[model samples]
Target: MDEEKKGTVHYKGAEGGWGSVRGITETWMREVDRPGALRTLERQNKPGGFMCVSCAWTKPAHPHAFEFCENGAKATLWDLTSRRCTPQVLGRHRVSELKTWRDHDLEQLGRLTHPMRYDAATDSYVACSWQEAFEGIGRELRAIDPGSAVFYTSGRASLETAYLFQLFARLYGHNNLPDSSNMCHETTSVALKKLIGVPVGTSVLSDFHHCDAIFFFGQNTGTNSPRMLHPLKEAVERGVKIVTFNPIRERGLEVFRDPQSPAEMLHLKKPTLISHQYLQVRAGGDIAAITGLIKHILAAEEKLWAEEQRHVLDVDFLEQHTEGFEALKAHVAGVGWDAIEAESGLSRADLEAAAQVYVEAKNTIVMYGMGLTQQVHGFENLAMIVNLLLLKGNIGREGTGCSPVRGHSNVQGQRTVGISEKPELVPLDTLAELFGFDPPRDKGLNTVEACEKILSGEVKAFIGLGGNFVRAVPEREKMEAAWTRLRLTVQIATKLNRSHLINGQVAYLLPCLSRTEVDEQASGPQTVTMEDSLSCIHGSVAHNKPASEHLLSEPAIVAGIAKATLPPNPKVQWDEWVADYGRVRDLIEQTYPDEFAQFNERLFTPGGFYRGNAARDRVWKTESGKAEFTVPDHLSAAGFEDAPGRYRLMTLRSNDQFNTTIYGYSDRLRGIEGTRDVLLMHPDEIAAAGLKEGQVVGLKTDAGDGIHREVGGLTVTPFLLPRGCVASYYPEMNALVPLSHHDQESKTPAAKAVPVRIVT
Candidate 1:
């Protein structure tokens, strides 16, 4: 390697240089060691030990071995590494010095060994005991109006922990639970809630095996969920037509060499999983492209009906199970071909081609992620996709449905077990009946709402269960300012990060046992339940030791805080529940009896269980008892109405990352070996703008909130993205995201479609 390349360091690498990096190699080696400090803890068979802290995607109960992904390994290394974040050590470092460290460096500093309170007087943090931390939080929280407290939960919080958190918040007389899901898949929930009734993903892992054609739009399965590689590869072998619609070409989408495949592993090669038809659709233009596909499908159906007397849509199913077809048809008719082509950057021919593929396949599945969900009209964009699938009667079938890929393993699970601050009338009523108290009827704040409340001085306390909430929110200035205004900020996490540094007036950083650590109670080794991407709920008992003696499981932490904060709250036995997680599960069973039946018995099963819902059989959970189509309107409206030099930019997670967890700086598929600073753009556009490859340039957007921030030192690279779309890594460019810029219905920031221009 060249000297420059050897010394190179950037935001986070975009591509495959994981093996050669010294720091990463050391971490990997440390991860493999057993019998030593790393191995001593990793090999023990205890509840809550050695859970992959990366993406919430889980393996189907393999023989007690290394069941973690690369990102998961990094998360484990982060918790168990030799680094320590002692109060005195951190106190020595100034706020500016701490701020100077990279996001990766801050997190790499090992476990927060003691509860620490950020002391603004000395501009440093000081050690505090668990009692002191809890008492401080309780005192501050008690002083604030209950409605002014914002409780944030990450997917990493176990089902027990999440339930107790909601209980604590409700008992405290508020429902302001902001979570990571709002930033990722809130659009899917909003669209599905209005159309199909269910606010969660319905697609099962088994559906991947049955689907005759899988249309993966706006998602990179390899980077997001590595475990998906096996199923996709199997589908290809069975002749399932795989189609991908993404701006950049991802290697995992093209082909994957499964290490588990003995034959392929011995050959040192991988099988191809490329899309039979690849469409590099423009960012924010997904709705137009989907609408065009639907139009083509309708056209083909009409032709088939005229000649062969065959209907493309399932007339029986449509008549029995859906409504609003006429309105949807009218909207589709109004969408002109010229507008579709111009907005989506795909020709009518490409739309027709994709439609033909969908039409020919017997069982089709459509999977998408933040790419489709983080747009201005994201909710409507998802509705159109559902409309396309529904036109062909694709949903609620043996092998056809929409799959919204959530980032965390138990994110959907979190919503399932009552992590939601937004209470549906039915659930709230049910909870009231079960718990003997009137649950808060008012809708709670989402991520954006929480920030707005915090900024306006309405929210005085911000308590996070387990996420980098400050870093995760957009427009850092407003968010940071609001956080500092809070009287109390508390984080219950396995390791320290930027969230701890950006403290409120009285902040406490409480370190807890990681998933890989032993979680014990009176019943001996305990097991926690997690929900996977496919809605499969299962038990996970760790086979490892605790990282440190002081560490506690998420459930224990929640219980501890609840014990200290709640003023003899009714309907919840915080101490008893903490004694054993099963009690929490029992309470959950009562609260959501329809889903978690025989919770204890079923959880013992190897794969745990699936929360059964009739919606899987196409029963619309909507108010009218039927799935409804939404009218597509102005998906690319921002682009058309905007002025010149405004390009739609999408922020993406690198292959080496999972949300805010940056393991290293490498993206294998994009061929970005060791840098995240390079922006992916069309060579033509870069050259036209008088910018050369590897040259740093500033980028500003004209999206409603007037975000004209400069992102200098950005290296440009030529990629296969559509002309109107450009790509950059997230958190780095997260500052460019305006807080006011969000989906109308879902309130999710349009991180994928901000209009911007390159500056000198």
Candidate 2:
């Protein structure tokens, strides 16, 4: 069969105008039934309704009539689709055959409706009772040593579920609790805690109203979190200078028209310009760009000092509340401009211009995304950003701080509620006092470490709370083979994906209720809580009925498995906690009294409660008892001197997808339609590689670990990218990222910058 006609159209208008409305209409019509779709959307993001499962952007205090964005609508409709993956459907297909399907096609099969066990004889999944499934999982878990089991959590899990997940794992004598945060924001958390004594963004959502300038680095705000455009547009209208640094010229950052505003919808108003200045920094060059800006700021400060004028640097604040300023100053001063321009892909004049905006603004907010965190220098990149903010005393003020834009809905909440591999961070002693068991103290495996352990036959059993572990991790082929070597694997999820098809010696798939479904317990209908990117913990109550009668809440699934796996413990009332989720919240309060005080009562208030940070209150809890500036080693951008044909490839999400979930093939923002197998590159580089537009090509990495790392049949599409830099969609390009390629400190895969060679 001939391939679907691939077309690329350049979009000139603002984002979130008629295009967004049309997208919502088409998604509702195709994925969900008409009247039901409208009803589902009506209850979305309301006070007593389900939360959007797309991005973790904070909800507005006074929401508009329609509170969700286009991607939010897609997530809701995708979850509430009127389709089912029943046992009868599974009987028709074999596991081996289903494994050949694409990731989107597997999820398009529909929501899983029953518990299933792999039957190797027929190479198919057979329906099994919930009790039988739990018992079988418990048996395998008990058969292995406690240290040899890996328990992974997804960001989609609720606070209550994540708390129980950690408790069960620790009580069962294991700390190998790796979650999705290890792949995305682990560096942000680690760096912030060491610098300003907190692991969250310092600014709240309302801070946007008071900022003088907003610096966006490596974040595509329009595509990742479309709802954030509302505040950004308002900020632009107020004359707040928005400086953007991204490798690609994102359409959302250029201009936006709010679909919710009647004036914009009626064509009575023009589109709002978002960025005052857009700097295209090369991939993995964030450190160099930020360093150059700091150098410029320091030079300007010296000039002002020489003229006996007021300087931009907060001298009083730095002396009173910060340390190591002299060392940081000397380090930046020694760096030459030539190195900065070479590594950052920008001239000294551009850096000085951007620095001038920062020097003039009284209060500024610097927000960044995976572009800065998914690199070899990921942790150092975060430290440099903090260093810049501290230089001007921007943090802990009215409208200035550091913000790390998280992708998953509740990823931060998952980590806050004890989903971590480090025992020191999880408060084992406090948990032992509350639950009457000595929690393990040893450091456990992270995402990358878990893969290595599994592959080496060290970890025998794996249980995923709610993520596609095999597909989301690096080294896809090795990960698949490692799964087959495991003694048992269990997936607690809403939809059927590739992870379920790839089986171990004994694999089980347990269907769970989605966030949109009402989770009723013994007491009454329960409400789950999630923490947004701004550290706001809020309640989300589901109003819709369960999609399938067989579905169970994530908390209940954890409880059932824990009860069958461990011996009876009177101190830890697993049954009562599962019966009433309030009991679990009460336990969380007892464990983390400082952060989660009055967890049950406060979570019910309108708009929820803010988990206060010490750094926001101007209190420093670091080793120096004050904010500290640290100089980072300068690392050059990824390039191959040995192989001139090699290009730096960065994996990115299309506009239609969230993380590994592919909603559709069309990325309307980038003007690509009908397919995802395309490499975005510069025209000059395409020609240099002897490749033409629309020509089929292959990508091979230079890891040389005896693993064949290549992806074929990719069409080269010419676009404006930095020389020697290219872009491709993730999970598809995840094959090119080697397991050994990750940050040394955070262990996050450097998906944004991988050296590769293009082959015809």
Query: Tens digits of per-residue lDDT for model 1 on 1-760?
Result: 1131222222222222232234335566654444354453343222233345567554453323434444555555655566666766677787757887888777766667777787888888887778887787887878878888888998877787888788788877788877888888888878888888887667776788789998888887767776566677778888998888886666567666554455654555544545677787888778888888888888888899999999887888778888998898888888899999988888899888888988888889998988888877888778887887788788877788888888886787788877776776237776666666777878888999988888888888888988898888887766786678788889887667788888888888888877665688776777777776767677766656676666777777777777777777566677678788898899889888888889987774544467865667777878899988888767472333545677888898876677887766766555676778877777777777677777777787566555456676788876666786788988888777888778888888888887777877
Candidate 1 has what TM-score? 0.93
Ten-residue region with minimum lDDT total, candidate 2: 1-10
TM-score against native, each model? 0.93, 0.97
In order, the Cα lDDT scores of the candidates are 0.74, 0.87
Q: lDDT, candidate 2, residue 222?
A: 81
lDDT of predicted model 2:
0.87
| Model 2, position 751: C-alpha lDDT score | 88
- Return the lDDT, model 1, position 298: 82
Choose the strongest candidate by lDDT: 2
